[model samples]
Target: MPSNVRHLTSAHGDASFEACVVPYLDAAYNLARWLAHDDADAQDVVQESMLRAFRYFHSFHGGDARVWLLAIVRNTFYSLRAKTASDAAHETIDEETHVLVDEQPSPEARALISVDIEALQTALENLPHPLREAIVLRELEECSYKEIAAITGQKIGTVMSRLARARERLKTELSHCSTEACRHDVR
Candidate 1:
């Protein structure tokens, strides 16, 4: 058991990490993207977090690797955030996740997806750091409350409260957008 973390699964080394952590790259990137609020910065953070995880892989006892990796991601994001507080705080989130049009959906379908994505992105952007993380982990990453608690180093109660608050905020935000949109003229 490491001094700082709870019991992680005791296992081999790099190969074990490769097996356990590699699968969660998307989840890590998603968390990083939400935290850094920029795809390129998120990629940088994930890259750094992966390196740190590899360096500290020995300390990782063999529990849930996803939780461990995301914790490192959160920590890395905070470290970078601290270093570039002014730049990071004011950085605009660039939406670059390409929507798959391979299915050849109708133009109307694409437009609806665009609008929903825009409003959701705007709402998520407006969320404070804590609430944003909770929602992103729970809603986007599909992490259990226990897992979220572990990754965030927060009690389950705190995680649940933040999720509830975040959900309310998102609901209000989306509703306002929908109503204001009035079947068209969406932002």
Candidate 2:
């Protein structure tokens, strides 16, 4: 056990805030990063959310801790955004310029892969905030529709509709990019 792990007496509950909440840090950060669109802003959101989660940990009953933490994260991000609405409008989300690569490819190997990471990212960023979140929660975060609904405070049907629209929009955008690329190749 790490020295930092806090153990509530078995009487209170076996679930440590560290055990349940820490496991979702990456997922929390990922969602925050996408929502906040800036690394520093995302870090702030996660930090505040963690604090809020710790404060309310005793209230959490046995259930999906990830979704619980994410709901806090999402709410924190929105609150932060609301406070900085004027400034946020002027600042571009870093996701537009940075690609999150899960795997490192050698320069030679990278040349062989023709995927336009920037285009995909731009398309994702262009989506309405709600639709963008739905896609990220479903596709990138791999949350089920029900979990997404809970985290987002949307009906399951709304989650499904947002996802459907998001996918269609992405497909249309990417297809348009492909068509433009082919036209350039022909010329």
Candidate 3:
């Protein structure tokens, strides 16, 4: 690479990194947080993944940047987990941490008309990492089976199966939540 060519390439790489990787920060963090099961670890994983992605930005071809970034995030999380085996065993309890206690509604008051996003998020947080990641990639990120396969390094068939199972789990969980709420109403 010539001096000017190298400089131009550096600039282009920087621009591409910003345009492609920056937008996927939330998606990356969500995936990492689910997999790592700790806010700080998740943050660290995403930051490290961003740095690694930038360092190898030249390798990226034009495609879905979210999938590419997610793959990096997934790899980074697993690598760190493997390197720190015992450390990975300590799982943090996030249920009470993220739960919001709304002011109790009076019996005569109109029933709460809307489902809380935070509650739904907390429910998602409680899902196992594999199921959670599948749901996040397929439902939240709207990634196709092929893209998810690339990101997860799984075959398309496995991706499809995981996604189907994840959806079923979520539906079952949500249904239980709804039934509980209805039971509470009857009391």
C-alpha RMSD values across all candidates: 6.3, 4.7, 7.0
TM-score of each: 0.84, 0.82, 0.72
Per-residue C-alpha lDDT of model 3 across residues 41-118, encoded as one tens digit per residue: 887888788778877888998888898989999999889888885854435546555544556766334234235444
Task: Report the Cα lDDT for candidate 1.
Answer: 0.82
Q: What is the C-alpha local distance difference test score of each model?
A: 0.82, 0.80, 0.75
Candidate 3: C-alpha lDDT:
0.75
Ranking by TM-score: 1, 2, 3
**Pairs in steric clash, model 3:** none
lDDT at residue 161 of model 3 (Cα atoms): 83
Residue-wise C-alpha lDDT for candidate 1, range 1-187, written one tens digit per residue: 1212111222333467677777787888899888887777888888888778877988999899999999999999989888874854535646467453545768888888888888888899899999999999998899999999999999999999999999999999999999988977646
The digit string of per-residue lDDT tens for model 2 on 115-155 reads 56767877887888899899998999999999999999999
- Stronger candidate by lDDT (2 vs 3): 2
Which scores better on TM-score, 1 or 2?
A: 1
Query: Which of the two candidates, 1 or 3, achieves a greater TM-score against the reference?
Result: 1
